[model samples]
Structure formats: C-alpha cells, structure tokens
Target: MNTEVVEEKSTKDRTVVRKALTYFVLIALIFISAIMVVFEVYEYRYDYRQMSSLLRNEDDLNAEWGRLLIEQQTFGATAQIGTRAVTQLRMYSPPPSDTVVISLPSTAQQK
Candidate 1:
C-alpha cells in the first residue's frame, strides 16, 4: 500500500510538470506573436504615411500643370496672337479704300 501511494504521487508530479511546460510554451508563443503583429502594424503605418506624402506631391504637381495650362491658353487666345502677329511682324489688314468691287452677271460669276 505504501509503494502504491508513492507511485501515485510520483505520477501526479510528472503530470503537473508537463502541464506547466505546455502553458509556458503557449505563453511564449503568444508573446512572440504579439511582438510580430506590432512590428507589422508599425511598418504598414509608416508605408501608408509615405504613400500619402507621395500622393500629396502628385496632387500638387497636377495642380501646377493645370495652372500652367490655363495660363498658356489665356496667352495663346486667337485674338491675342492675331494682334501680336500683326504688330510684331510688321503686318496689317488693308482698309476698305484698297478693296475693289467688280460687278458682273450672276450666271457668269459662278466661276
């Protein structure tokens, strides 16, 4: 009877040690997983911030391009160019005095 009790106590001790080791392993795994998750979250957030800054720069560049296009169109208007071309190139449009009016029969004027 005493030997049986001793064997039972030894088996119980072994079982408790195994349970403790298993819990320790599980806890360590959970801690490592939590650390990895934190690192991934930080990296993702940093990348997102960088992407946001790049997007802002692109928007700024697009806005500048739009503004430049508007300025170009304003300056390149047909009336503006016609004036500049005439004055700067020493060109002109003749007045009515230089125009000649030829009167002919409608049937013969078709050519």
Candidate 2:
C-alpha cells in the first residue's frame, strides 16, 4: 500500500507538470502570434502611408502637368498662331491669280 501511494503521488505530480507545460506552450504560441500580427499590421500601415504619399505626389505632378498643358494651349492657340504668322512671316492670302487646283490620279492610273 505504501508503494502504491508513492507511485500514485508521483504520477499526479507528473500530470500537473504536464498540464503546466501545456498551458505555458499555448500561452507562448499566442504571444508569438500576437507579436507577428502586430508586426504585419505595422508594416502594412507603413506601406499604406508610403503608397498614399506617392499617390499624393502623383496627383500634384498631374495637376502641374495639366496647368502646363493649359498654358501651352493658351500660348499656342490658332489666334496667336495667326497673329504671329501674319506679323512675323508677312503671310497673306493667296491672290486669285495665284490659285490653282491639282488633282490626284486614280489608283489605276498610278505610275
């Protein structure tokens, strides 16, 4: 009976130690998973911020490009070209005597 009691007590102690280790392992796994989740979230947020910053820069550049295009159009409009053509190049309408019409031949008449 004494031996049986000692054996039973040792077995109970081992079972408690096993349960404790299992709980410790579970807690450790949970902690590691939480840390990994936090790291991923942080990295994602950082990447998002970087992407947003790039998008904002792209927007700014697009706006500047649009402004430049508008300025170019304003400066290169037909009215401005007409003025420059008449003033700088001394261009004028063709006189009636200088007018002529040249017609293209049909495809079958090509050289």
- Cα error, candidate 1, residue 82 (Å): 0.9
Estimate the TM-score for candidate 2: 0.64
Ten contiguous residues minimizing lDDT sum, candidate 1: 102-111
Model 1 C-alpha RMSD vs. true structure (Å) is 7.3
TM values, all candidates: 0.62, 0.64
- lDDT accuracy of residue 39 in candidate 2: 100
CA deviation > 4 Å runs, candidate 1: 78-80, 83-111
List, residue by residue over 71-111, the lDDT tens digit for candidate 2: 98997897888998999999999998999989989999985
lDDT tens digits by residue: candidate 1, 24-96: 9999999999999999999999999999999999999999999999988987897788998898997887899
Clashes of 1: 0
Query: How high is the lDDT of residue 85 in model 2?
Result: 92
